[model samples]
Target: MAGTLHFHPNNLFAPCITNLFWFKLHHHVMVQFKKYVESFPVKPLFIVFTVLFFITPSAIASVQISRTQILMGDVPVTLVVKTAKKHTIKVTRAMEETFLLGKKLSDSLSEFSSASDISRINRSPSHVWISLKEPLSLFLLEKSVKASNLTEGAFDITFSSSNKHTSWADLAIDKHHQRVMKKAAGLKLGVSGIAKGLIVELMSHHLTKKGFDRNLVNAGGDVYASGTWIVGIRNPFSPEQKPLTKIKVKNKSVSTSGLYQRGSHIIDPHTHQALGKKEAPLWASVTTIGNEGPMTDALTTGFFLLPFHKIESIVQQNTGFKVILITLKKQVIKISH
Candidate 1:
């Protein structure tokens, strides 16, 4: 029997076949095959057919994630999550809870805040008990102290006389008892270096648990990514200049340190003074990326204190870490694996 074929622009199968005989045969077979197709279970078979029909060897779905911002650690933090479809409700709730938890943790650890729990600890040694959900924040403090020691106290966190001679490691954590102990009287613990990074990490973990496989959490300049993300390192000297370098990273962190944003915040711990404003004509901003956001954050400050040659040597000693230094004269230096 003679049969006719019809093509629809919106239909994916319309463009490939040109032979009228094959097209007529296909049309006739499909027209008569309705009962056979309908015999299969509806939902599951429909899904399978839809998937197979769409897999025409060239069709692709470019799924994009959504981003939201929340205030945490005295700064606006942006969280990005990628899923099959929009999940604003879940994202908003997750972010709200994350920020609340972060704020509570920050309140417990901040040394600068007058009413912080750590401040109360500074006043009296009565065994201040602090609870934190973010373990990386505590870990960062320990690592920062060690980094400070390695740099000969260049990055000391105990600069304040009120919190003198303090070590985060000295503050023992009784996980079984859910309490932290500090022996020294005036010793205070602060998570300034790690708080923002910890917030990003925690938020990423939370989103991943919610089925978000690709996402980025950025707290100011500290950024953490679970999948490929784009990051730009600003040029410290050139206010109008574009980023010194752009990087694509996954499951990693990137941080930049310069005299621009928080000028005197990164003080030389040993000198107890501001890092000299003497700008290096060869490089103004130094950005570093590594396994941990807090480490990248701390190392950026440490690298700013060292000379160009020393920066290369230090980066070489540490594998899997990339560094980009931009000088005042617009020179760019990159060290990466």
Candidate 2:
């Protein structure tokens, strides 16, 4: 517990330790406080403990929701949000709304799933336009297009679930009607690279608009914090042990795309396959921190597909983004803000 909140002042334990456990302890403390109430010299520490334990400014609520099913791969989806208990209803409602939005976005982007916007487009006949209709779908498509362009097709979304024929160059958007068209008849899209971050963004925005401060939204491993939050980076080699590093972030999105979380080379869009020990050594795991979830999410995947030397231009152009690369040899590469 030395490295825990006992030393860190983030009020982490206040939310994690349940009131039921503290209440039982509170009863014993009250007994001791009463015994020392009349005799101040007897146990002054008991009164202090009782006050700190029971009379907190307010309760903090941390909730984790299990999504009905797994997402892209066999990776199960979980949504977590933390906030002050006083606004429990608001936070819960915000989470509910966010999850619904996530489902819609997932169905639209998942190439593995059929009957979605992407699947329908792929299933469509050649040169036929499929209507995106929904504004959110159009927005996500736009972001994916931009990500592909920004990464020079490294972060392409045109990866089909069942075929390898489609690519970034085959996509086209009609802004006048808010629709997207695929030049290749069987083109499919997968936005899992950036969708996780968008979910975090939406959840954070909804929570913030609901008047909650000190809130955090973590969808699986993608995270965004509106206030000071201590986030842990997963250990690539060891999953059962503690996190490799803990960083405090505020008003930022923290995204880690690697084989550690997905049990495969999730960051590699080109191969759509896991990397071997001798393959892509430096990009074994990539962690990027930024203000936007989409940007952080996009960079983690796009940069992982490129060589370390090739990533210099991206970081040099972006002012606030920071990246940490853990090589296959266990060497650490840090790019400062």
Candidate 3:
């Protein structure tokens, strides 16, 4: 196998600073064999075949074939493509496509950008159907609505709205027309909780469609693994920021939400206020692993704001979901179906 790892030196989210590294032990071995055979005189034809047979397999075996690349932005993204070295061209194209898709999704969902789809939707006249340009935006909105329903309003995108009456229920979605209307005034959608995971999902899907079925896409703390991956749960309270534990998952998504990640960014939908202030948060971090990236992301945020029993009940109801809760006291609790 052959592999390349790329990273930006200034990227704070990258694990290492190496810009690019090529691992081609097989190539090195072939070069060494050519020099050895040229310097020796013994049955050249038979010796050449014998050396090639032994070295070819060893060279291929030593080559690290996976391609791992990092993209730095508001949220750091890591894309891993697992394929044979012969498919380098395909892997390059797949990475480019996935990166472009991720950028588009981020731009469309960014509330800070006035020209973004979310911002345009927010500024649109209330109760009037506004046509959507980017189909990705509409897809995210539909998923947002489903997430709100799944979490029983605990993961509402309308939590950012200042209007007391505004909620996810007031948003009317016309999927056939690719339009939406919010009945309540001042209803603004804040989809940061699930947008990253959507980005991960779409990027992973694009790679898989391009024949790279064994891949991993991680945006911030939201991750989607197409094959088996061993992911670690970070210890938020630890000064060294070590992993408290690790778990192996197959074809699943994992997302972690906590005050440690963004410092009280999560809001309680019911109270319409930032969490972890009035009362100490029950858990320091909530890590959720599930079959769907968006849902896992939403659940991580939702579980952080819910009580233990409520979280447990929700997890039990969803067979595909499991959660790892790290308490303020540093205790780890694992819940699963």
Candidate 4:
């Protein structure tokens, strides 16, 4: 019978043929090795069996595991780690510890929690110094304060207060003393916008300390990638939820603040209100990549509120920062420094 042959690399039949060829080659080699061993005074047959039984599978197989859950009450957190099968238990244990660490940090920073340090700051009387006991809380607050300055008040933690005159400027932060005081009464501050990124960054650091060579920590739209990872940006207008683009990042954080992710949820600190269609920028989504997750997260939110020219200026000022702007009309613009 005449038969047609298919040998395309992408086809299933090609793999079968390749496996058969390798099997025959291996069999022939083994037969020759046996004959040679018979001629030798002593044979090392156990060495060959050990290589086939122990090392072959280990060399061919690797393991990847992931965990996804809603962290910090509402934010979605995902952890992905890759390693050899032999270290599966170690990686899993590291992931569990990382999750616990994230939860503890979230609880400490949560403004809704009466026991939280932030909530205590909100409840404190004006002009009274409150010593921050937790090191993590102090660090986060210091970072938030710095972010306000970096973004020119566009990334203020106190942006949500009903009092328009009260802002981050009204708060006195003493990082050296580990204390803070609100100069204006009812000047409530919340780090919900930037806290997720901070948590993810710390989680990534913990995983690295645990000896995970390849890992990723994603909290909502904020992400930190260790080693190399390809992350996808979602198409906001796609009904089928396709990726708008993909970017490879190594030891960096990529954050996206978009209308698609939250739908007019970003409040303009300047106006003390949600960004209306008219008030919003021409870009529907603003993504920023940087070495620090919190900064990238803050930049994305700040860029979304600022004009395009202003955003370009900020991107230029920051070294090693990259911005991707997706316009309302679906045009993509990139700015890198």
RMSD of 1: 7.3
TM-score, candidate 2, is 0.71
Q: Write the per-residue lDDT of candidate 4 for residues 105-207, one digit (tens) a residue.
A: 8888889989988999988889999998788778787778777786788888898775789988898988898999999987998888787888899999999
List where candidate 4 sits over 4 angstroms from the true fold: 1-54
Candidate lDDT scores, in order, read: 0.63, 0.68, 0.79, 0.82
Q: Which structure among the candidates has the greatest lDDT? A: 4
Q: Per-residue lDDT of 7-96 in model 1, one digit per residue for the tens? A: 634344554245677766656666665556677668577857776877833444434545445555357677776554345566666656
Which candidate order results from sorting by TM-score in descending order?
A: 4, 3, 2, 1
Query: Over all chains combined, what TM-score does candidate 4 have?
Result: 0.83
Clashes of each: 5, 0, 4, 0
Off by over 4 Å in 1: 1-51, 54-70, 86-88, 112-117, 124-138, 162-190, 238-241, 276-283
Best by TM-score: 4
Question: What TM-score does each of the candidates earn?
Answer: 0.69, 0.71, 0.77, 0.83
Of candidates 2 and 1, the better by TM-score: 2
C-alpha root-mean-square deviation, each candidate: 7.3, 11.3, 12.4, 8.3
